[model samples]
Target: MSIVSLSSGEPTCTTEDVKAIAGANGFTITPGSVDETAFLLFANAFDATCEAIENLPEYEDPRLKPVIVDGERQCHRPDAVENPLNAWAHKTTLTIPSAKGPLAGRTIAVKDNVSVAGLPLGLGCSPGLLKDGKHPISPIDAIVVQRILAAGGTIKGTATCENLSMFAVSYTSHSGVVHNAWQPGYATGGSSSGCAALVSIGDVEEARQSGKDTRDYPLGEGVDLAVGGDQGGSIRLPAAYSGIYGLKPTHGLIPYTGIAALNPLIDHTGPMTRTVEDAALMLGVMAGYDGIDPRMTPESPMPDKVPDYARDLQAWIAGKEKAGEWTADGAAKGLRIGILKEAFDVIGLDPAVADVVKAAAERFRSLGADVNEISIPLHKHGAAIWTIAARPMMPHFVAGNPPDLLSHTMPHLQPNKIGQDYFDTLAHRNPAAVNILMNAAHLQLKYGPALARKAHMHVWELRDAYDKALEECDVLLTPCNNTVAPKHPASTAKTEDNPDGCSERIMDLFEPAIGNTLNTCSFNVTGHPAMSMPVGWGKVKEGDGRLPIGMQVVAKRWDEASILKVAKSWEVGGRWTDSR
Candidate 1:
């Protein structure tokens, strides 16, 4: 092939831009004008590079069958907040009309991080930070979104997510601090804040017609289900605090395509619902391989194969009833449950919280299951190793452009500018993001990539340890958080001197995360399916009245069905939840 100079339809590189960019990669450029020979050399390299880039495989869209057309922006409100519970990120109301399916007539709210084609995706970041506006209407729908719409569900709106989906507390959302549905002053336990709140209360207009504010600490009787993504316990945390059932399904079961991924390896999307059955029903629709997501494979569970995971729960309930083994006091015979001592004994766990969770565990024993303490010493170190590994590596994926559009990891990671507006607002609105970014930067600079690489090795060991422990028991139990719905640092009235209680001394980012991360984050990194179900209520020293306490149940890989059965069994038995 001829080394053609100034080839037709080739990418043109400006001299100054080329020099600046090439300098970063250790290339030196002289200020003098280049001769024809040098220009030809540049052209030769450019043409070859273009050929290589063009030759790379393009993403193949799953092209799912639909009532709604693909790539159509069906709902949105640009440059404005939609409503209070929906958050400031973007306001939208959409229902991609579909014929009757399993989830027919069900209303759902999806987290902002998940894409709905033609709807603005704020990703819980400020409008100005994104190039076009606060809510950038997504060009394509995420796999879960398509699945839900196809299953005859109604999408209420795009719910608010924490800024960059980084914080556990709802107050850090880009639109604004989200109000706790249970108590006005308490944290909603985010980044799935809007979904939890809105799903529980029902539609804003309809709830008002029913003479309820919808935001007035209503239970999830109105809306059917909500969807949430978990990179580091986002789904489980919000559901726990909001007193609903939330599951972080085993990673790779649901295609993550079209979601704004914080970490490819850790991301999972699942159902948050008022009832365990609704959660299982939603899971039956959402779980499966979509060809688009690079992470999904043939072995992952498919909804069709396990048709009616929702209905199967009743069969188990019926069997227990037939045996006369099921009583109003207890249900589910011959089940074995293990309570993790490490999660209980973790740093600074509230005694009251521990008591409530323990009572729930003991109920399983009353229900005829052998309940015992299973020790996995490595679990104690999960959070620490997660910090060393997951925390430090997240900024690379979130702040920088990923190598692929679908969820993927950048092997040769390099830090990129996260944009100025993000930091400027995040400093005050989400100090947690500031802390995380700064911590990641510090760790990377201090130990280099070798430290993160070594930390991944520890993560694998932790997963193996958890798997071995599961062999002895069907499920592992833990308190979801040390405190149930702690008063929001920004909004709660604690001292009486300050009604809002958002004073500078009290505005601590790590406080909300203190007890929450110890138990939940371990499952996130290990790709294990874990759930947080509202089991009992307890009063906190920091607040008045009894608050909801969630018990986490983690099952072995692809064993979500087992855990769901257990959760439903305990729920129907009526001893554990009613004891509060």
Candidate 2:
């Protein structure tokens, strides 16, 4: 007689486990005391369990067989044999052409964390999974992947992401450091490291001069679009660092149906691209109620119309679109931008960064838009609120669940089924993952999860403060990051005594990174739309050539049109790209 297992649990249960199980139940079972009689009794019980299992009705498979897309896999890990900046995880070069879609001929790179049916998705941190010689490839295309193909975008490959997508910097990936596309040595704020690098690259002159593939697709240009996930500024941070346009849309505007998320509540998936028009195009095609992702309810907050993002942006920039339905020429002329004073007042914010941002704000004011300095006292607590609100749920992500939309588990971080090396890497110090997890554990142990509950209440206060400010203004403005991209962090070799210290060295990034996230993370909790638009280029270093500086725009929930309108105005005013 065989016992029918209730569910697949721990793969193994040794005799030590049995004793422990008995101990947990307030009983003592000596190692060999139960003897043959107990074994016979257990066998008898298993017979009944098996009989019940056989009598139980069987459940049919719930999932429909997906319409398979024709494609082949071509793995491209440049760190293995080529340049580190070559950030393609797998380049399928697969073209499922659409006859009349808006994104036709655009080149898109899906971040590696997203499923691309047959491409490898490492989540950026696991080394052991790949070393096992059996790569667990995605069998079904993620929802966004399907959207891109349907919209006629040609996928180049899966873009590189930071290791386990834990850090904001590009250096921690197990594959290798993801270098800045603008200035190679400086960091590309991540975990959308590859998405930004690919979008920022301008070596197209060399590619054109070198006479490469320039026919149907053309050469000497960066990617037209890329999809990136944001838990705490992953999409916007890298976009700021690499000098590109990135949007972290309202928490649920885009379906996170098939994405790897850090925390369910704060998780977002958005588009990063070279221009505001392109970003809008990508968003227009991707957002809607997917019938999965519970975040999409009957009352799902969406634009009055869909798929008109780029057209609207074009009209708005040309001074043709209206503010709403009420007035024409109001898209730009009537915009009210609220600049958060505390964002610039961050205690350790770089002075140069502050000055540059202030100048940009003045530019907005001078341009005849209604821009004013507004105060949100609790703005300083954005990062802290995000910390308490997001990190406590990380343990669920650490357990690794996909929390698939079809599975109907929104607002929950599902376990990633892959055998992650999280435990193996635990002995190793990771500036981002280890520190965050350890800190979360300490908080729960010392203060209990009740603190997390209280933090939710505090989140309301933060949101209310921002909402009150937004009521006075259409959007809030701030610097995306305080300084230009910092130099790449130096690596430390694992040593006998300092083995773990090597992982902790990312702590060095805190000084430059801390203030950078203040303005961005709050929106994650507030669930508002935010964007980073490259405004100007400034010296990230003393003598190094100027790199991109991005200004962040935060709008009221579901007001993506206003954000794009302002961004398009800036672009059409001749600040689309640096005059390099």
Query: Candidate 1: global Cα-lDDT?
Result: 0.72
Clashes of 2: 9
> What are the TM-scores, per candidate, against the unseen true structure?
0.84, 0.81
Candidate 2 residue lDDT tens string, 410-431: 2122333333355455323345
Error of 1 at 247 (Å): 0.3
> Residue 350 in candidate 1 has what lDDT?
84
Give model 2's TM-score versus the native structure.
Answer: 0.81
Residue-pair clashes per prediction, in order, are 3, 9
lDDT of 1 by residue, 1-580 (tens): 5455434454465566556666766766665557434654675567666877778864435462223633344564433223534342444445545447888788787888877766677777766655544455555667788888878887766777887788787766655666655565567787888777765553333436676333443233236688898877898888877778899998888878777777776778899988888889998899887656776666685656744678887788788888886774557567879999888988878898889888888888777787889999999989877787777667766665673444432212223357676666567667677777788878867887888888899989999999999999999999887777776665433347743233354357557766577888888878889998988777755756555678999999888988897897786557233565
Estimate the overall C-alpha local distance difference test score of candidate 2.
Answer: 0.70
List lDDT for all candidates, in order.
0.72, 0.70
Error of 1 at 493 (Å): 11
| Candidate 1 residue pairs that clash | 73-118, 82-91, 127-134
